[model samples]
Target: MGRKAKYSYEFKLRCVKQVLNHHQTVEAVSELNGCHHTTLHDWIRFYEKYGKKALLPRKNKVYSLPFKIKVLEAIEEDSLSFSQACLKFNIPTKSVIMNWQKTYKKSGIKGLNNKSRGKPKSMQFKRAKKKSSKPLTREEELLLENESLRAELDLLKKLQALIQEEQSKKRKP
Candidate 1:
């Protein structure tokens, strides 16, 4: 699933129309609509390249590793800009290509593999706490006793500080 679009299709269409049909400057239309000029320019570009359908919200897509490599190769071989590559590949955003390029550069083909989304597989199967059949050894018992003593000491120190703070406040008054 993809995040909901901040701008509605109709709103984008209206902005694009204002620029293309009304012949208004991108900056003027964008400023009037309380959006960035570059954003408006992108809308215009998508509209010109892919028609009205491009303005609609797209579902999250998982590109295969081969397809990812192909897109990267095309960009490098054809010397395509991010925007041009996006338009050619029908990618919704340029950031997708940029991220793919970064991943490819850092880790090669293995990095391009689509990682499983959401909670990891390890988290799904929780390890249940096993009850020990035998009693704790003498050293183990000492360690547990020491931990309890440390906790008790910390609690007493906190209580002492609170009592001191209270006494100081009363003395101040």
Candidate 2:
């Protein structure tokens, strides 16, 4: 599928201004600007309610735990399906709510917290710890990491020298 269409802030502002200040109907302005009726309607609603701040496009959405629980509870108590809840609450997708439900079931409310989704950055490679060994102290770990990096650099230098020696031997022959 093609990438989703993105509208710029200036474009949105100009379109919204045409409808708000110029006394033009949404339908007429939308037709003139080649925007759909529903998109224009949503823009008008954002402009009316939250002013211009709401008009800017947002990439990241951080939903509160309470909101997630409330939505799930509403679905349960009201006997509404995922699609129904999504439409009623103006949510983008059902999978988001479903994932939240799964996390809630596995780890209760704590799983809903926003955390980094990948491995932490460290020079030391991550390996499985032996059950009998205690965890290394921070300073000791840093020393080990330094030694590992130094060894890696030394090995690379040796390989480079060996490659140059081989090239020289080939040229001479």
Candidate 3:
């Protein structure tokens, strides 16, 4: 087995940028970076082809529609198996193709964009919580009730003081 090649994000971006600037062929930059010529060519093609977006790290289980379309197109053209398509595109999952196929079958192209498969019960609970928090836990309820009683008592005490002050003034007069 061959040793794995590694390049930092900055180094790869620099190499790709240099290739796009046309200062040197991809072959030369790949040599300088100790990367495979084909790898550098693909990197340059990807960078030139996709711009800044291509440099972003991909999320698992998320493939762009264009990339999905390309995978499907390749599969259709070459009658490639899932594994073959995965190898061809360096796609992360065979399941991704399967998911796309499932989505396409159900709702066509619009289905390919990000979508929730179904409303989970937990999601419903979360929504409910947002709309109104669950009734406070027993301890919290008791605390709130105690606080409310204290506020009412404070108001009552102030009222009693005002009444006592009025009676005292009338007696003085």
Report lDDT (CA) for all predictions. Answer: 0.92, 0.80, 0.73
Give the Å error, residue 136, model 3: 42
Worst 10 residues of 3 by lDDT: 123-132
Clashes of each: 0, 0, 0
C-alpha root-mean-square deviation, each candidate:
7.3, 9.5, 14.5
lDDT (Cα, tens digit) per residue for candidate 3, span 107-166: 888888876645665633334334356677899889879999999999999999999999
* Top candidate by lDDT: 1
Encode model 1's per-residue lDDT on 98-160: one tens digit a residue: 999999999999999999888765656769758699999999899989999999999999999
> Alpha-carbon error at 137 in model 1, in Å?
27
Candidate closer to the true structure by TM-score (higher is better), 2 or 3: 2
Residue 110 displacement (Å), model 1 = 0.7
Clash pairs, candidate 2, are none
Clashing pairs in 3: none
Which candidate, 1 or 2, would have the higher lDDT against the true structure?
Answer: 1
- By lDDT: ranked, best first: 1, 2, 3
lDDT of 3 at 18: 81
Model 2 C-alpha RMSD vs. true structure (Å) is 9.5
